[model samples]
Target: MIIFRPPKYDAIDHEKNLKESDGLKFATEIYKGQRSLSAIVEFVLSRIKNYVKKLHNFDQINKYIQGRTKTNKSKILLLTDKNKPTPLIKSIAIDYLSSFETAYITIKKNEKDEIFDFFKIDKDIAKLPQIIIIDTKDNPNEKEEIIVYDGDLNKVALSHYLSNFATPLEGPASKRMDLLNKHKNINNSQNNKKDKNKKKKNSKNTANAHDEL
Candidate 1:
């Protein structure tokens, strides 16, 4: 499982700072193909810098901390294959970021075996499109609490499960305003139709009264 940690700054040297961290060690292990666990570790490590950069830019990191504080829960990390098409996963991640201010990392397929071995994943369990939610707070010796699920992108159950960790935002302010305006236009059109109908009815009643007179 990927571990999400807050970024630390060391003015002395940026490369050295990242290299000395646990994230680097994990990246190195994956780079070295620890026990030949994953073939894509090198790719993951190479691209890790970009991931870190993006994470640094993420505004939800603070919310991630707040969520942990309020719920007494650990930060979340995601494990998934790099090669698999992840439109659903991407959507869920976006929603999580928008709602809860938390984002997760995706581990490529090559690293899956090692994770499975370490976590003692059952042999009968299917591998691809799997999500492993881990709570990494508290004592180091304590067994990590994990929840595993089949990675079915179309499943509402999986989406709901992820929703617990983050709230989905409607999008940018401009987009929201556009939606509001569109709704208003629709309401106005309906109201106009109703008014026209009322006028027609009144005119018919006046005509009938005149005929009777």
Candidate 2:
């Protein structure tokens, strides 16, 4: 499981600040193996960002991610600290990520805690932001690694760490999304037909009035 906890953004009341926080610049300069993180994570993040650009409703956002996790049998989770103020992207781009986590939960068959099975460590109450990748495949406590990614949420650690563990699956969440989109399309078609009929009726009424004149 990959966890991205954002820092406490104090003064960013506006949404425009997120554009400047792309940490991928460093990720590009840094390479591992034959693959650049920008090529892997950047493309993936961009697709998610683009797909969710117009999405505002959490339910809709949740539905969109139900199927994609099946490719790797990986599940995503979002834990928002209501105590802290998050950046605007938390409601937008990161919230797109929040959708994947949401869909993972709602569409999941079993109600289980399969992520973040780490050791209990007592530390400072001064909470700094962290990107914690907890691998619960063998045992949760032994396989967890954490990097304190303070200052901003845009970090490169999670993309590399995500593909390690195999997650539990209950049923296909994609089915729920399929049905929802099916109904939505049917409704849209019906609405469009009604609109055309209404327009034609208005046109006929105008013609009758002109004949009378």
What are the Cα lDDT values of the candidates?
Answer: 0.48, 0.35
Expressed as tens digits, the lDDT of each residue in 144-199 for candidate 2 is 23322233444223332332332112111234445777899999999999999999
| Candidate 1 segments exceeding 4 Å error | 1-78, 98-112, 136-144, 170-213
Locate the minimum summed-lDDT window of 10 residues in model 2: 103-112
- Model 1 reaches what TM-score against the true structure? 0.36
The CA-based lDDT of model 2 is what? 0.35
Top lDDT prediction, candidate number: 1
Candidate 1 residue lDDT tens string, 162-208: 55544344322234546887999999999999999999999999999
- Backbone clashes in model 2, listed as residue pairs: none
With candidate 2 superimposed using the best TM-score fit, by how many Å does residue 180's alpha carbon deviate from the native?
A: 0.9
